[model samples]
Target: MAQARENAVSEAPYYQGLAKSMMFTIALVSLAPLLGYALLSGYQYTTAYKEKVEAHLRELVLKHDQSVDSYLREKVAEVQVLGEVVGGDRLKAEAEITSLHNALVRSHGSDFVDLGIVNAAGVQVAYAGPYPLQGADYSNAEWFQAVKRRRVFVSDVIFGLRGVPHFIIALLVDVGGEQWVLKATLDFMAINDLVEDIRIGETGLAFITNRAAQFQTTPRRDMTGEVKLLHNILARGGEDSILGRGRAAITVVDDPVTGREVLFVTSPLKDGEWFMVYQQDTADAFAALYRIRNVGVAVLLLGTVCILAMAFLLSRRMARKVEVADQEKDMMNDQVVEAGKLASVGELAAGIAHEINNPVAIMVEEAGWVQDLLEEGLQKDDNEREVQRALTQIRSQGARCREITHKLLSFARKIDPTVERMCVNDLIREMAQFCEQRAKYANVRIETSLEDGVPQVEASQSEMQQVLLNLINNAIDAMDPGGGELDIMSRAEGGDVFISISDTGCGIPKANLQRIFDPFFTTKPVGKGTGLGLSIIYGIINKMGGDISVKSVVNKGTAFTIRLPASKEGMRCAAGNGAAGEQPPADGGRSEETGG
Candidate 1:
């Protein structure tokens, strides 16, 4: 079975290509999911990174707000302490108040712009430092009223009467039961420095806003006044932002000033009316994510290429394996076919030996009888008839021996096939004549249905006759217990002639059907039959550019059908064209059937 499979592969060159195609298909199927995963993961990573940047901005805004608030609270606390130490009415003394303001300003790091002492009636009784506002009226001022109501106030950036951008920190004190306010102006430089200290990603900017959504400390110091109101950003940002809500949170928005998509984090300062706004461009923030995506794509492409390369290499290896398998099969088939031919030759040799031995034995006995008569009487008249009979018997036996040797020589002669148009019925009749007595002895009935005017086939008569003879013998032998029918039929159809030999006998088993034409495979008992009969027959039909097939059922019957090209020219043309691979030429060749 393995050899037969190998031979089929050897005969068909396209099988290896088929194997390669299959491997390629499998490789593609395996790669589909992996490719999808790589693409999906890259997308997901970028999305997550965007979210992460927003989250980080949320943290940064809170920290920045804390720093600003800490500075403002410290300034407010210092003023509150001064109000407690100095009495309200006594602060009307300008030298004592001016010295105290100088000490406080010196202690407060460079943020203190100026200081003023105010009476309950909204009058600045004393003032010190950079601004000359000692006599400045606070009676109708907003800070004077706010300080009296709130006790302490950290105002947003504003220009004082001195025409400078300095926000105020005011503390209301009850000194000796007389209401007084210590009002200090904080330098805008300190607020600007505080907002600028928040460092974010590339293209990031930080700014502070009052409760009115007006920029307090703008990145562009030139736009730091009321003109830098964030009209669109605070308006479009939800109710919480519009209302100056205090919760620290992050949002994604398009910057109104820069018109770039950015991550915006809003955190309220300690005063509750101030906010620290941190904005980072989305493109800059997700830069690391882009690199990760690129690396993933590169690795994915590399893996896909490697997979395809391996698939190609493996497919080539598989194709080579198929090719090798085919070669081995052809060799094995050739070996089996040759073996069958040799075995058949050996069987034929034995049959001829038996034929020759019989005639030779008869001649020897007859010669002995003549010798005895000659010894008995040369002159006796009575022995003449007996001597003459012995001589005649010897002559007849010698002629029989010569005839048997001639038959043996004719059968042994290796001759090339002669391509000719011949009636298949005639060939069948002649071959059947040799096996008739054997069938009769076995109680087997021979039947023939030779169609008249059947198209002639292009074949070698001698080889065709041998093929028919082998099939007939096998059919007869299959009916081991006798009383079976053997039917031989010939017909013409579809530009071909079909000859079928069928037997009603013990049939071939299903398991053995495929192997029937294999060398030395037989169901017959030992020494009863050589398995080469069907093998030789198959080889002959195949060489003639014909096909043979068998149908059988166990214990019922078996039929073999042989199909040959109906017109001689058809087969002859096919042969001439070399259509039958590795077979003989159109003119002639022998079907090598021999016995051992």
Candidate 2:
């Protein structure tokens, strides 16, 4: 873990860049759709909501227009009935007209303000209720002229002699072959109430306007600036401005007065003489829509923040893991290079051993000849003792040289993977002997304990030899400079063969103990170690169905233990091969101690 942190620090820039790239990628992928959905859904909702509001306003104006028209027709019908029932004679009488006006007021609420009788000259001969102008001349009045042209006439709101806003509904009657107008004043406030009743959100109200853009009904608010704007709209719109479009026409324009966008719903009233209009500020109409949009934007922002945070953390963690893996890969590559160098050294040593073999054989032959000559003529005690001792030393040194060369040659041979029976004790003894000279040079002692009648294992002999050689060499190397004791032991118990090699040397630290068998992990100096010895040994043992473990204490010693399953077949085969069917040697179980 410490190593991993060091590596991360060393490659900080690389990991940081990786994290940044991943973070952006994650943010883009997450936010793109969210933003798109927000925009699309918001647009759709806004359009639909606006259409709904406008529709509601249009319907309200249309319904109120019909009500106003109906009110006017009822008043007209009442005037027509009075003229026909009372006849022109009674309608001209003040008392009769007063009785008719009172009856209208009682039956129809306050919709009717007064009643009057008009001659062909447009003179109001008789008037009843409220106003005191009993004989007003209407010879050129618009309603009087219009009523003469038609059987019934409902005038636009106007302030006639009484000087108040009201409209007159008049009926033309043929009384004794002469035309007279039966007129009734409709209450303007009654119609105004109908328009005023239309109320929606803030800034929503309705009013009635004539063709000249004159206000017929009292508006809820001042509409002086709106009147001129309406004049232009009605002028350009022509006769069917409101009716031709549909039941009601809707438009949105910036108000000249408020300088704010306003929605207008207009419908024709009284056969297009007046228009019922519903106006509202657009902002107020869509307040809920704008509110929902704001909330959605807030939620999107919050989600974006969460997505970015997660992306940053996740990317950083992933990059950290990648950095550690890269460090491990680099270490593995270095180990491979070291193993290659070790291979080259082994080839060089093999070549040197082959070259030295010829010369050593020639030297051995010369020593034998010298010994033969000394045995035949030398008789003096001092000279004979010296000559005999010298020859014995030469032969002994030559034999040692031959043994060393033979062992090197055997190790140089290619490994055989074929499984075969092998005695664990013998292999341990052989490795101990092979490392004995190196131990002597280091001044280290070699000790061996072999159990007699130990069970054999079935494995490749070359691989077993390699495993033992690696362990033994490591033990000798550990006890270098100032040598210590090296112990190799073998035993059989519980259906398994166990081999342990231990040495008293500068021990491995606890931090490195677990990683000792890992490839490319070593405590030795760079050039002196391949870091693959124990790892290779571990692989070989495990391949042959065996296990290997280690234990160490700093400045004390280290021990490696190997366990291989004992093969009963191999033991039986060994027994069958014994010479003359003799029992195995008793000395096999003995512990031998050798020192330099």
Candidate 3:
């Protein structure tokens, strides 16, 4: 039965494709947007949610801190007042001490469990507690020793006389140069009540621990009978944490005793030797958020199913229209490219000439460097360094020659799809350098005044380079051996950038000027001019949204003014010097115009 089912499924091709397409459509239309929206919003909410939780927790802890400070200060003031009383001669009598004890007991100060008096010998002389702690030796206790230093002392938490849990506050008196002590004690149970009165959340617990990690009070009912010992996790790690000894950090882990996940936060207490902890049960902390998330996801999924049905039909229709239009645009662009290549041979002739001279110049310079090194008496160390430098220069110069040859061959017969941005001023500078020395051979003086901040217009970098070089070479050819001036200036006039190449050569005749940009038009003797320079220049400038015009007079100079539109932006962004007003990258170069 299974073999028959498999064979039946294999026989159907269209069903498989339809199934695949449906799955694909559902995945993209439903899954993509839902995931994208959730992910983007989740990232933004993480920081905000954490801050909200932390602020609420801090408020609960701060209130306790304020209460603790207030309670402690009141007790300190009580101890201070007693110190002054003992130093007074009238208050130091036995009758005064007995009256004070009786007044305290009548007022329900039984929680202040102990009251004691010490004689000048630093021994307890009178005591008021269930067990007579009279004559007890308390001189060694911290409160007793501290009072000797300042006549008044409030000791930090400590075990009291008779080994009952009490903290002592003591005062010293000096009568006739002899010292005495008056001490009061508060049961630790009073402090424990303060800890119990703190009302925290249902899942949250608060507790206090001493400097020794010994819990002074805990909310744990099981641990009520004994002092709870808490571990400082970071103090134990020693190596992993920067928090030394007793310092605390928020801890998220399973509780060792209860086996439940706890989110614990700590605040400094007891001058930072102790930590006040607020622990929240992890399960309870996230219960509300989990409920909200589940409901949101269910609704989100149902709405997405409806959206996918509509999106599938819309995407299919739009995609088909775009595919057809793109194909037609591609064909038109191909025809425009072919038309540009067939326009000129003047560029070809100039490129071939430059290519031939490049190698000869390199050889001449290399030979000169070698001759100079030999004539200087070539010391071995200096000779070796000079030879190395010469080799480097030789390699670099050969590379330049190869590049020029490549450009010349490309100009001669090759047609390539070139794409680049050409700077108006930089292109003129490069062409002038390449052809100016050739002008020296003809005794023609070529002058240049290029404007600053010339814009970089889009075109093929190499193709536009050929166009400029060809124009400069043609101008040099028109000059005389005795001396004819060539002035080339590139500047922007409003929205247009103009390159004017004016030469004091035999001026163009009226009829010749009209035919200069026509394909294959030339005035030079046969084999000297390919008649393609002006035509190629015209096509290139036209494709670049520019126009070329000539003005000449008989026996005077001829000026060719080529005007092109300013670049989309003044400077390209990829260049290191791009500032706020700079141009951004052009993914595809734009078309320009040509003129006769």
Error of 2 at 301 (Å): 2.5
lDDT of 1 at 212: 67
Q: Across residues 1-596, which tens digit of lDDT does each residue of candidate 3 receive?
A: 46435644673454445545765786686778887887677555645665566566666665665565555566656655655654545444556656666666666466567667776666877766566777888767777778888776656566665676666667776555678777877676766677566545566777766545566564655533323324544234233334542233456777667767766666656455455666776665555554556666776677677666556655555554444454455455444334443433444455446666777677678768878888875785588588678777878777766655543443343233344456766556545654555676678776777777776666655466656666666666666555588888877778777889898887788988789888668777786666766776777778778888989875687888988787776573222232212222221221121110
Evaluation by lDDT, superior candidate among 2 and 3: 2
Error of 2 at 16 (Å): 4.9
Q: Which candidate tops lDDT?
A: 2
Tens-place lDDT digits, model 1, residues 1-596: 66456656675658666766867786788688888887687678777877777667777777777777887877777788777777676666788778887887777766777778788787888888776787778887777778788999877788768777889888887756778888888889898987787766666778887656777875743443323335344444445655554456566766556667766667777545766777677777777887777788788889888888888878777777877886786567656555654555564565556666877888788778778878987677778888788778878878767655554444445233455676687566544544554576678888776776677887866577667767876787788585599888888888899999999989998899999988678877898667777877787788778999999998899999999987645422221121111222211222222111
Q: Is 1 or 3 the stronger prediction by lDDT?
A: 1
Q: Candidate 1, which ten residues in sequence have the lowest lDDT sum?
A: 572-581
Q: Report how far residue 403 has shifted in candidate 2, in Å.
A: 22
For each candidate, the alpha-carbon lDDT, in order, equals 0.72, 0.77, 0.62
- Predicted structure 3, TM vs. truth: 0.43
TM-score of 1: 0.65
How much does each candidate deviate from the true structure in C-alpha RMSD? 8.4, 15.7, 28.2
Using TM-score, rank the candidates from best to worst: 1, 2, 3
All candidates: TM-score: 0.65, 0.59, 0.43
